[model samples]
Target: MKFAIFGVGGTGGVIGGYLANAGNDVTFLARGAHLKAMQEKGLTIHTNHRGDIHIEPCKAVSADDYHETPDVLFICVKYYSLEAAIELTRRIAGPDTLVIPILNVFGTGAVMQEKLPDKTVLDGCIYVFAKRSGPGVIEQPQEILRVFYGFRPGQDSRLAEKAAELEKIMRAADIHAHFTDDIQRDALTKFSFVSPMGAACLYFGVTSEAFQENKEVRETFIGLVKEVEALGHAMGVTFDRDLVATDLRLMDAFAPGLTTSMQRDVAAGGPSEFSGLVSRIVTLGKKYHVPTPLYKKIDDWCKAHGLA
Candidate 1:
């Protein structure tokens, strides 16, 4: 499949690097120094699982420069960048193009679908500890790379076959891609881990090790996860496992000193995903009549700190 990766950060960089390294047709949409580096020196991925990959002669361009319609377009930008991505999609994506958003914020694809009613936007999530260490360079700190995507319940299935084929292609590139049957539950399952972690880490101004050792931090994390679980249940999601326990297990398994992107962005004194990852939960809690006291507390803290 001809692939277009929008926002070639850590997640998109790894995905596009692997696919292109596997001899698949891939075009990366990036800008500034990253785009310049990829255009001149090509894209490089540093990974423990795959040693390292360098895709020279890489096809990298900004969204404004890209004119070809691709078979699949992966929206990998930050939540705050979704409006620009949507505009790019509106201008470039054809009717037959498949759009998949593998963002940390849950329900992103559905949000995009609402904006692009004519396109096929599949809800997707990825599990990987990756970041762009430099221009045209991506670092995967861990080997845990998994992707799940599927159409939302009661949505159109006209592109189901194409989604399945894309799954095969991704797996062939060594991605643990699953064309899941229930994206709502699966996406929320991933969200159950990320939202709470981001909330606790940003709220307390700590790293991954704090959640492991600090009793107060750990309890806060657990509380946030339970709130997400409650909201999910209220939204008619049937989770297969205990979300708090599962998230705690994942939290304990994290590498020490690790921090979420939101934490990093806020620490850098820039725009972060506080609205999507943290504030969104509080909003949903009110919408679903679920109590999210922990998230509300954190959201209030962010507002007071001028971080929201």
Candidate 2:
């Protein structure tokens, strides 16, 4: 498939790098020094288990410079940049294009689909510990890379075949990709881990190790997960596993000193996904009549600390 990674940062960089390294036709949408570096020296991914991957002579360009429509476009930008991604999609997405957003925020693809009603936007999530260490360089601290994507329940299935094909392509590139039948549950399952981790880490100004050792921090994480799971149930999602236990296992597996992108962005005093990962839970709690006291407490703390 002709693929376009619309935000060639950590997440997009890993996916694009692996696909391109597998001899797939991939275009990367990036900017500033990252774009310049990729245009000059190409993209590079540093992995712990798989060694390093180099995609020289890559197609890296800003959204404005990219004009070709892709068979699949992964919108991997931060939730705050969704508008820009939507605009870019509007400009380049063709009739047969499949748009999947593997963002930290839950329900991102559905929100994008509302903006581009004519396009096929599927909900998706990714599990990977990756970050851009430098311009045109992506670092995968661990080998855990998983991707899930599919049409939401009751949505159109005209492009299901393409989604399945894309899944095969991604798996061939060594991505643990799944074309899920229940994206709502699967996405909420992923969200059940990320939202709580981000909330607790940002609230306590700690990292993964803190959650592993501190009882208070760990309980707070568990509480947040339960709240999300409750909200998921309220929204008619039938989860197949115990979210708390599942999230706890994931939490324990995370490398020590690891932090979420939201934590890093806030620490850098830049735009973060606080609204999406933290505040969104509180909002949904009210919307669904689900009690999210832990999230509400953290959201209040964020507001008081000017991190909201």
Candidate 3:
């Protein structure tokens, strides 16, 4: 199947590189040094489990250079670039195209579905420790490359069939892709980890290792998770698993010195998903009348420090 990736950063580059190297028709829409590098040097993936891969003679085009629609489109940009990403997808995606935004933020499927009403937008979130170490060079430090996605239960259409096809394609490339109707619950469960950890990590200017080393940091992280979990419960999302324990397990499993994308962006003074990951929780809490003192404290710090 034909695939087009909107943003070839950590998430997009890995998936696109894997698919393209597996001999699939994949085009990457990217910009800057990364695009140039992919055009000239090919997209290189330095991975842990499956070893290294180099997709030479790859297909990569800037937004200005791409115009063809594909069987599937992956929205892999940071949450801050959702507007521009959505507009670009609108231009290239057809009605039958399956668009999956495997971003870090929660509620991305709803946002994309609302914006691109004519297209099929699947809710998705990834579990991986990946980053762009250099231009066109993505490094997956861990083997956690799982893609969770699907339509809500009983949302009629061909999405279930399409999702199964997409899952096969992803798994064929050695990527773990799971389809589920309870995407909201899964996304919120993921939010309980990413958003809260990101907020606390960015606020303290630390990484995952910090949570293991410092008592105060661990407490703050756990508090943030509980706040988000409370908000999710208030919103009628049932999370039977021990959310905090899961987060701690993942946190401890993360590589030493591991930091979230938001923390990295803040450190670099670059654009991030501050509003989506940090602010959205507070907004949801208010909407559901769930007090989020911990999130509120982190939000206050972000606002005061100009991190937001």
Candidate 4:
């Protein structure tokens, strides 16, 4: 299938590179040093799952330079970059095109629907960490990356069938894929786990393992999850109490060296999704009359550290 990938950063670069290598017609939308390198050399992906894979002489162009409409458009831009990405999607979107946004925010599917009313818009979640180690080079955190997707509420069967077909296609490409019945819950579930870990780690400047090594810090870490869990439930996203318990267990297994990408971004002074994660939890807690002292505390700490 023909594909257009917007914002070909670390995550986008990895996925797009794989599909391109698998012989799919993939066009990457990028600019600056990364784009220059992709154009000059090619996209290089280093992963623990698949080892080193490179896509040299790959197809790429700026958003404005793209001329061919794609069957599928993968919106992989950061949350802050969504508005511009949408405008660019419009430039290349056709009547039957499908838009898949891989993001952490909850309401993005709805936003995409509002903007691309005629197109099939789906919600997608990705489980992988990647960084642009160099121009056109990605350092993948895992050997295999996984993607889950589903149609938004009130959408039709064609999108579902399309998602199923895509899953099969991804598996063929050696990229794991699954169809989720409820994408909203999946998104929130991830948020419930990741946001708290990120907040706690960023607040303390330590990995989850190190954060949990100290008794008091570990307790604070769990408190962050509890507070976010309360807010998530109040927002109509039900999470099992046992899930929070599982988070703690996983943290213990992951150790104090395990840090969220958000924490890493904060330490590097890069733009982070703090507002979408912790800030949203704290704001929604107030709206739902839920107590979020832990989030408030960490939010304050992040602001003080100039990480917010």
TM-score of 3: 0.97
Return the TM-score for candidate 2, rounded to 2 decimals.
0.99
State model 3's lDDT. 0.87
lDDT of 4 by residue, 28-90 (tens): 999999898899999998876677888878898888889898988999887878888778777
Q: What overall lDDT goes with each candidate model?
A: 0.92, 0.92, 0.87, 0.77
User: lDDT score of model 4?
Assistant: 0.77
Pitting candidate 1 against candidate 2, the one with the higher TM-score is 2
lDDT minimum window of 10 residues, candidate 2: 251-260
Displacement of the residue 72 alpha carbon in candidate 3, Å? 0.9
lDDT per residue, candidate 3, 124-177, as tens digits? 888878889999899988888888888865555575677788888889988888
- Output the better candidate (1/4) by lDDT: 1
Stretches of candidate 3 off by over 4 Å are none
TM agreement with the true structure for every prediction:
0.98, 0.99, 0.97, 0.89
Residue 298 error for model 1, in Å?
Answer: 0.6
Which sections of candidate 2 miss by over 4 Å? none
